[model samples]
Target: MKKSLIALAVIAVSGTAFAQSSVTIYGKADIGVARSIGSDVNELKQAAGSRVGFRGTEDLGGGLKANFTYEHRFLPDTGAVANTSSFFTGRSIVGLEGGFGRIDMGRDYSAAFWTALAGDVFGYDGVAANGGVAGAGYQTVRFDNVISYKSPTMGGLTLEASSALKEAGAKNGSAIRVSYASGPIAASIATEKGLAGQKYNGFGASYNLGVASVRALISKGESATGVESDGMLLGLVVPMGALQLKASYATLEVAGKDTVQQMGLGARYALSKRTDVYTSYANNSKSTAAKKNGIEFGVQHNF
Candidate 1:
């Protein structure tokens, strides 16, 4: 009887410890077939960047918590690594969180990336995405060896900042962003200085009504030699039950270079909570070249 009692006591203690910690395994996969106006061949493609990841959190006393995430991208069609050289190619983060806010150190995203994503309907990885304009002119993406901080929201306003340390004679990069979201309105502004003497600034905003949401962003950048360029993107989203409609337009104008424009439309139908079917079409036009159009049909599932 005593041995059984001791076994039950051990099980109870172990269960309580696990109740204070949680871990989750999550991933998304998307694949599609696409055709372009100029090409007669159909190609297999990853509609959006496919990724798998693990995340966990542990609660500590005094309102503090420890968190971690490890993620990587892959090509679903071929089952090949998308990041190639890096293992945790999507995001590898370790951080601490509390009332004062959260601080993380790892290979992570830039402040300008968050700003651009604030108004992008299709995000950066999609075929019909509008982030190309901003991404082309700025390093509004991931950074290696970064330390970042995000403050707690106050009156719907939040602040974020990040820094990448210098290495091998390279210049240090830094970025900052301020954002506000309340009710039907959202807005953000960000600026960054990347290595190789590149500088960028961006602003974005969006408004939501009962049936639709509209968003827009503009970015300006300068190269190492002082050549300047500007980019703009506009997007709209409409939701009807389990179906959604998305559209966007983007433009980029560079000094001493031809202007580029793109327009895209897409639709998504949710089959369940974790699976969806989507299709998109995009037209690309260049001032000095012929126009091209592409279409994509794909399915996505999350687990």
Candidate 2:
């Protein structure tokens, strides 16, 4: 009888401990058929980078918690890894959060990238993707060996900063962003420096006016050799029940070089809460080169 009582007691304690922690498996799968710029062949592609990820959190009392995330990106069409060098190319991070906000270490997105994403009406995917303009003059999307912090939101405003170590003789880089989001207005400004003498500054803003959302972005990049480029984007999104319409125009100009411009149009329809179908068209033109156009039709699912 005593042994039985002890076993029950132990089980109860274990259950309580387990209740303090939680883990979630989440991912997105997106695939489509498209013809890309400068290519005459239509092929399978990812409208959005497909990825699977695991995230967990543990409560440690006093409103503090420990958190971790691991995300792997892949090509849904061919079942191949998205990045050849790193398995967890999406995100691999461990962090803590509490009243003091959150701090994370490992591979993570840069502050400037987040700002750019805010102004992309297409959410960074599809043939109408604004990646070329949004990410112009910026470092790679994710940084390795990075440490980052995000402050608690105060009156619709928050601050974020990050620093990446100089591993393998790589240049040390740092970035900071300040953002505000309340009601129908969202805005952000970010800057990054010290990546192989590259420097970038970006600003993005969006306003929702019931019928539509308008977004704008501007960025400037300077290289070590003194070459500079400026980029600008304007976009809009309109929602009509389950269907959404999007359009955007962007331009990039380099000193002493030709200017490049892009125009895009897209539409997405929600099939359900977790699935959607989309189509996009994009045109690219350069002052010194022939114009190119591409189109895609795709489906995306979240799980």
Candidate 3:
């Protein structure tokens, strides 16, 4: 009888501990058919990078928590890894959060990219994505061996910063972003320095006026050799029940080079809460290069 009582007590303690922690598995599958300007045949593609992820949190006492995330990206069409260099290309991080806010370590998205993403109506997905303009000439979207922090939101404003260590001959990098989001208005400014003194600064803003939401972004980049490039984008999104319309124009200008311009139009219809279908068209033109355009149709499901 004493052994049985002890076993029950242990089981109750284990159950209580288990109740304090939670884990979730989530993923998205997106695929599409696309035809580019120079391609006569359609090709299978991932309109949005497909990914599967696991996240968990443990509730400690005093409102503090421990958290971790692991995400992997893959090509749904061919079942291949999207990033050959890393298994968890989407994100892999462990962090803590509490009244002091959150701090994370490991690979994660850059502050500049996260801030600029708000101004892109397409969320940088699809052929109509404006990420080329938002990122400009900077290529550091996610950094490895990094440490980052995000402050608690105060009156619709928050601050985020990150620093990446130099490894294997790679240069050190750092980024910071300040953002404000409340009601129908959102705005942010961010800057990042990477690789041999190359630097980029970006500003993004959005406003929703019931019938439509308007977004704008501007980015400037300076190369290690001091050459400069600039990019800008303007976008609009309109919603009609389950269907949404999107449009955007973007331009890039580099020193001693002709300006490149792009225009995009797209629409998405929600079939259900977790699934959607979309179509988009994009055209790019430059004074010195031949014009190119593409169109895509795709569907995405979330789980």
211-268 per-residue lDDT for model 1 (tens digits) = 9999999988888788888888899999999999999998887895746688889999
Per-residue lDDT tens digits for candidate 2, residues 46-97, read 9898999999999999999999999999999899999989999999999999
Q: How close is candidate 2 to the true structure, as a TM-score?
A: 0.94
Error of 3 at 188 (Å): 0.4
Off by over 4 Å in 1: 1-9, 36-40, 256-258, 287-291
Query: Candidate 2: lDDT over CA atoms?
Result: 0.87
> Scored by CA lDDT, what does every candidate get?
0.85, 0.87, 0.88
Q: Write the per-residue lDDT of candidate 3 for residues 134-215, one digit (tens) a residue.
A: 7776736888999999999999999999899889988988999999999999999999997577888999999999999999
Minimum summed lDDT over a 10-residue window in model 3 is located at: 285-294
Q: Estimate the Cα RMSD of every predicted model relative to the unseen true structure.
A: 1.9, 1.8, 1.9
Span of 10 residues, lowest total lDDT, candidate 1: 284-293
The estimated TM-scores of all candidates read: 0.93, 0.94, 0.94
C-alpha lDDT of residue 273 in model 3 = 100
